[model samples]
Target: MIFYNGDLWGPMREETNSWFSRIYSARYAACTAEEGHRNLVLTMAMDLSSKTGKELELPIDVNDLMKGL
Candidate 1:
């Protein structure tokens, strides 16, 4: 996921935390691409906090995806 701006930090954190909580019991993977400045840090934090979640780095360009869309 790509966050264009950091203004949504509060909401983003809450959402990610909620997601992590739900999947805490099961094995899951959080795959994120380097689309924005804050995405890496946020996803990394989530990955580290989750007991069963693994973080995957996707080599995708959000800008290119957006252009295709």
Candidate 2:
């Protein structure tokens, strides 16, 4: 049940518990440790909005930023 970087999760909740049992599994399904780690480095390599060339735009409401907010 522990939360990892951003929306990542690892290890198991119990001996019989698989990753599919967790709520965040779907988000990290395609992201492996190596890939995620590499992407992490790439993400840190960029300055916020610097590589994008233009300012990032908000696609949704500020008050509704979160999944359940």
Candidate 3:
């Protein structure tokens, strides 16, 4: 089964609370993202980072993207 390590951390902008575009992955794939581009992986990371005590969103549909893989 596919899963993600939810310990989301990032390099803070030199003392700022905001995270840079890189989210740490325990699986060591070293994922990266362009600024403001909400790719599926990043969306999952941000959802895991949330602490607002709300229900999570549904999983992203990567079927089409995965077809070529």
Candidate 4:
């Protein structure tokens, strides 16, 4: 199980083509994009491990895993 406490405000904020971006820039901003990306990779890894009936050890450094993104 994974627990995430980071802010999702940035990713949840509605996208726009005009001044709304600037208007809510600071009000709706967080590190959710990066956190979501990491969670996606981890979820995939867990799914694959379960499908193969094998224990999954995350041997790779998280920073290294995130570098490609």
* Cα lDDT tens digits for candidate 2, 1-69: 566674544543452254455434554445577776666444433333464454434333333333222
Question: Where does model 4 exceed 4 Å of error?
Answer: 1-31, 59-69
Error of 2 at 67 (Å): 33
lDDT agreement of model 1 with the native: 0.52
Clashing pairs in 1: none
Question: Model 2, stretches more than 4 Å misplaced?
Answer: 1-28, 48-69
Candidate 3 global Cα RMSD: 14.3
**Per-prediction count of colliding residue pairs?**
0, 0, 0, 0
Deviation from native of the Cα of residue 50 in model 4, angstroms: 1.0
Please give the RMSD of candidate 2 to the true structure: 13.8
The RMSD of every model to the true structure, in order and in angstroms, is 14.8, 13.8, 14.3, 11.0
List TM-scores for all candidates, in order. Answer: 0.26, 0.29, 0.20, 0.40
Weakest 10 consecutive residues of candidate 3 by summed lDDT: 15-24
What RMSD does model 1 have? 14.8
Question: What shift in Å separates residue 65 of candidate 1 from its native position after superposition?
Answer: 7.0
Q: Report the C-alpha lDDT of model 1 over 10-33, residue by residue, as the tens digit.
A: 446776866677589665445433
| Candidate topping lDDT | 4
The sequence of per-residue lDDT tens digits that candidate 3 reaches over residues 16-68 is 32233232333422334543334655555454546444544444344532342
lDDT of 4 by residue, 21-54 (tens): 6556656544366875677779766666667777
